[model samples]
Target chain A: MKIENIKKEFPIFNNKVQNNDLVYLDSANSSQKPLVVVDRIYDFYTKEFSNVGRSVHYLAVAATNLYENTRSAVQKYINAKHKNEIVFTKGATEAINLVANTFGQKYLKEGDEILLTELEHHSNYVPWHYLRKNKGIKINFAEIDEHGDISLEDIEKQITNRTKIIAITHLSNVTGAILPIKEITELAHSKGIPVLVDGCQSAPHMKMNMQDLDCDFYAISCHKMYGPTGLGVLYAKKKWLDDLPPYQGGGGMINEVKKDDISFGELPNKFEAGTMATAQVIAFNESINFLNKIGVENLVKHENDLLNYGEELLRKNNSVKLIGNPRKKGAVLSFTIDGIHPHDIATILDEDGVAIRAGHHCCQILHDKLGLTASARASLGVYNSKDDLDKLNESINNCKKIFNK
Target chain B: MNLKELYQEIILDHGKNPRNLGKFDNFNKDAKGHNPLCGDKVHLFLKLDENKKVNDISFEGEGCAISMASASIMTDLMKGKSEKDAKEIIEKFLDMIKEKDDIDTKLLEEDEKTKLMSLGGVKNYPMRVKCATLSWHALSSALEDFQKEVTTE
Candidate 1:
């Protein structure tokens, strides 16, 4: 499990992307999966496939146990107090929508405000925006500082009597700013407000503890964690899960149904309706195990070193203006070239087999605030090395040469 | 497949200093175009004379080299053409970008055909075809006075 040899685990690296080795820096969008996680999906379908929580057949029982085992693994991985607090959805967007719909249905009233930061991805903001339209709830934003970090003071300043919930990103996908989630949660709790953290960018790269951070709801994207697509995890406190109304109704999430009256199932099942992403849910356990084997601290250290190296290298390159420069940052390096648009930069970079994300990265509000239409982002992951970033720098230089910068 | 074909000297020159890259007062028709994927945008303004021929054309926005150059070249070629001729040229250019092997230069002169043919490189880059066609789409929408903004989703 040497960190340097981590790239060998991902089969993508074994092949060439357009006749060049893949310098994947788009992990913040979605991570490249390891062999174990990919194999788990194949093995589950080939050998041990069954619809979970359904029939009493032998394969069904085994599949049920394996599915629930991943739930327990997720519980322990995020250190949630209760296993039932973890609910699986299609993706992080669905997880946030579930919370917003259920919470808005039960608690949010007219004129109630949900405080979000400028760095929130559209997934985090759009779901709450539904409440603004339907329930007449107001959404407020905490502005980012010059360095693009959202401070506890900024969160506190936006809090008022009408503010009901505080939703924020754990780490900005654009700026790489890691917010003070624990302190923000503590502040919200002091004001008797709940906090929802969009951990799509944070959960894969950093350590997370539900009880430690004390956020009421945390949404995670499994694909971004080197797991399969079409699966996400929502970690909420037991009380919130217990109190919130069911998001969607179907066969699996029902306790009793009659012609006139129906009672929903309990905790995790209440949130998860119909046939879930069975193979993806089961395979995600390998993703958790993969992270555990390499260890979060090591991944954090490796990514931090890569980020610093990338920052220094890109900083030295003239006309490559790095965005944010937050005191506490993640593994994303978002920048813009002076004479070239980000799309042009990405196109040229792709010519060299370097995969980076360009455009708003789903943070249009932040981009507008920064007076930019788009930017090029090179995000890192566990498998990324300094060599990959070196390629990014070289490709950026090639882009400058092509753009006549 | 060929970056050189996509980033030709003419294309780079137009992208660097785009032609008609500003708003014009007293324009009769205007339309905005947006590429949501890349966040590139273009606002095309045009004035048609009594004979329905394009008297002036201008654009204001920012985008990639392909998009800016496409808009720049499009505006330069669109001026002085009838609305029907402009529509036909847009269709021909868009057809070339999508699937057509070559544009019908019968509607265009030799230099106009050459300038528009430079963008034929976009056909090799599937993701960027929209960038090369966005301004053309906006111009078409402006001709019809489409109420909603045109978006290359």
Candidate 2:
């Protein structure tokens, strides 16, 4: 699909929001779904619906094939070495929790440490914190510099002999700072430490290759990638999947359930418990196909243009102070108007059908570090255009006029 | 649906220059309220006298114009009223915010009722109703000596 006509692919843009054309700039919170993803979900339920992987009936067999097909597609999409390495999860939060729980069980003990950064979303940090509280593991944060970017040197400085795992974000949801995950992985591996990347933001906008980044585990949120909600992908190296224990115990993940002895199933099944999100997993294959058709390189260049256009527009506006000055950033544009609260700015902008997020964007630690309780963010996706940024500027000017600034 | 109704002149004035916006040196009851979604916070302080009458009412926090104005107007009308009367006014105000078109309270003067009704404009915006009610909930928690912090989840 061409970038210029991408907005037409999403049915939501055809409808008006509050009597105005929808200028959705909140893709970082969640991307709008295209017609193909929506139709795939409907078609699966109406025609090929089944509980997948259990029954011997024709529909069950077909549904199971459809479900496993998504795993294979995701493996190829992320360039995982083995098809069994991609595990379907409820969402990225659970994916991170799975790694934290199993890794904490097998590798960590008291006085051991997990290194993180200030830019991590709460989903990444809070799960590890459970280990800190229950198992007495410590979490050390590598602070961001004035530019809000976490450099390789910063990660190296925070690394200690006790650092067992390094869990960090591939890209910040708030500051849009793209971390040096490949180099960070190299540094951590040199010290005999494993790396888990929270790829919720990066997987949508960037080209992801598990082999190239060499991170031990990577988590993805499908809904943020224009797929259905309640479906996630966890890309773990075959080594870690083989070494770590299963996260949950249930019917599908069991190989044998003898009275006294029970054994787990194979690579991906051992981690996925209970009935999975069948329809979402099947529908996410369409999401992968959608991304593939657009081409990751084209998506990258289009979003980069939007980000630069948005940044320059907001920078020219007086009293609009942006959150970060990172040299390497993604599609997030967070800022604060000097005298206007972010909530008020959001409320005013909503009148013009300009939707943006006004909060910590689930990175409260980063907000606190920046000495702000909240900020306004305008994020981009493939469907976004320069016209949307122009409308955003006009709406901001209206907000300023209302406040008599 | 109209932005002007939601942000009238009175609300903007009060939000810009809120009255009774400081901590009390001696306070009988206090409660903190927060809207975790928007990161808005309000710390309410009350000084109740021997006869259970409000001696002073003040607040300190940061939020949007609607929230700040609601808090400012709420604090301005709550002072010098007895605890029983305060409860009645709070109920009336909350009722007006929830569904009622207007509040009729014997405790408040005609002009005070008009000031309180200005916040009713928030009824049109479902998401922002919480912004208009967070401070009032905090005030109620403070009055009843609720031991936990108030949150509009």
Best by lDDT: 1
Model 1: per-residue Cα lDDT over A114-198, one tens digit each: 9999999999999999999999999999999999888999888888899999999999999999999999999899889999999
Worst lDDT window (10 residues) for model 1 chain A?
A: A339-348
DockQ of each: 0.66, 0.61
The CAPRI class of candidate 1 is medium
Task: Identify the runs in model 2 with alpha carbons over 4 angstroms from their true place.
Answer: B8-11, B24-29, B49-51, B124-127
Q: Across all candidates, what is each one's fraction of true contacts kept?
A: 0.68, 0.57
Question: How far is A285's C-alpha from truth in model 1 (Å)?
Answer: 0.7
lDDT for each candidate structure: 0.92, 0.92
**Each model's chain A TM-score:** 0.99, 0.99
> Distance from true position, residue A79, model 2, in Å?
1.0
Q: State the weakest 10-residue window (summed lDDT) of model 1 chain B.
A: B1-10
lDDT of 1 by residue, B65-142 (tens): 888899999999899999999999998999988988778758799888877777887687777888889999999999
Supply the global lDDT for candidate 2.
0.92
